[model samples]
Target chain A: MKKILLSFFVALAGFAAHAQETTLAPDQNPRYAESRDRYIKAQDQLLVNMNTTVQQTYKAYDWYEAKQERKLQRYNDRRERRLLRAQYGNFYSPYDNNYYSPYRYAPGFRRNGWRRGW
Target chain B: MKSIFLYATAAILLVTTACSRKVTRIDPVDTPDISGKWNNTDSRLTAEELTSQILTEKWIGDYVQAKGKKPVVIVGMVTNKSHEHIEAETFMKDLERSFITSSKIGLVQSGKKREELRAEKADQQTNASVSTMKKFGLENGADFILQGSINSIVDAYKRKKTVTYQVNLELTNIETNEVVWIGEKKIAKNVKN
Candidate 1:
């Protein structure tokens, strides 16, 4: 019985040793295969990101152009209004809600169609 | 005589019309792009982008709030890793201009300019008066170094090609070697040759 128990203990030690040896042993993988695959994945992701970023840049440029155009239009509108006011603003009368040229002054001026000086 | 005068007048008119060239002076700020390449537009846009992003970032605010003054910076090496001979100086100058105009940050002289300055000061010590001589070693030491790279990729097929430029700028603390700020601006162009 003692001999039998001793054999059983020896077998258990051998199995444990085999398990450790196998655990520590290197995998029969190719050179940098796992790391290379991971690297390739990352590269692919970066490329994809770059592609999207480039596209976004185009979109951003277009958006900025449109915004600038809108701003210019607004500026032109304000400028046009200013010019119109400078040109014909004096002709307007808030009291009558009307426009009257000095050459064709309002009814207060004497005669039909006031002279240029008037 | 009459025919000669008429011919002479006509010839002179023809020559004048043919020789006269129209020269227009346009605003440099809103200059038009005639060629599909990196140009002033790109530089200006990049400067604006960097200024807007960098100035408003948390790093500048945190530094200012903590230090009670603007952070001093030195423009370091910015390499161009592109197929074309791209000049980083133009945009870098524009960036410095923005920093100065904004008054949110400070910029110090760098590179060949800095060296030239030191040389001039050394000359000043011997040549100029004691009060007029500029002293060295009292220059503002930059707390941060701004360095970056301009990388590009060209994808060409037949008459169509796409140019992508990535301008990556990073501000690092000179003492601690910790990266304080990083800003990236991407500009792309699609050309048909």
Candidate 2:
């Protein structure tokens, strides 16, 4: 009976050793399922943060660009308006009788007067 | 002898415990510091910046003669060829809004405004019992159509990965298939265990 009990104990010890050898340590074990889940969560959070940052930066950029653009547009518009005014200011309608100045007629009339007196 | 064995066992246990306790310190999983001044290379506006740069170029500006006329633009499709599912619409909308707010372009809402005008005219004709209602059609077609695409490539190792994204855009004439403008942006990111 004593021999039988010793054999049984040895068998149990061998079985336990085999089990330990087959099993992996906690850290080394495949927690891929769990790690994958965590990774997905982390990725989602990162994406959200990235999107928010992008939006904010884009908004700020747009604001700055808009302000600068408005200034430039106003300046250009003013310059163009001034140019148009200068170029078209001396223009007159064809129907206007005073299209030419009266100085030329003054000289011609004087010559005609002298000829008439002669 | 029993005391010596006890001491030896304690010593072995202490050594094993110390070896097993390998201080991992979990130092907050080094995340990418997306906060600071990032280059336009890694930014979302890379494509837009490039496009704007192209637009501002003296040659393009001179050719377009768009100086006098506000840049009238129409947003078209943006195809995605990236591995990850990304919405191109969001970025396109941002660009459209930027153009509108900038006032650099006389943005005409495609069909929507014309429809509204037609409805108004129809209502007027119904009320007045007049056949002399003004017919409204495509009063304005877009001078330029903006189209683009997004593509990506990825490489990965054991808990380490790299992703690259590329965005390209083009402006084409409505009457002609000529590509009047071209723009591109690229971004790359690295992640590790």
* Interface RMSD to the true structure, each candidate: 13.8, 15.0
What lDDT does each candidate get? 0.74, 0.58
Candidate 1, position B185, lDDT: 92
- Cα lDDT of model 2 by residue, A21-93, tens digit: 6676666646555765787879634333211112111122233345667999999988886675354332244
After TM-score superposition, the amount by which residue B62's alpha carbon in candidate 1 deviates from its true location, in angstroms, is 2.3
lDDT of 1 by residue, A15-80 (tens): 999887545325644454566578787963433321011211122123334566799999998898
Worst 10 residues of 2 chain A by lDDT: A50-59
What is model 2's DockQ versus the real complex?
A: 0.01
Q: For all candidates in order, state the fraction of native interface contacts they contain.
A: 0.00, 0.00
- The residue ranges of model 2 lying beyond 4 angstroms of the native Cα positions read A1-118, B1-44, B47-51, B58-60, B63-68, B110-135
Q: Clashes in model 1: which pairs?
A: none
lDDT of 1 by residue, B33-98 (tens): 675677888888888898788888999888889889899998877767765666777777778888
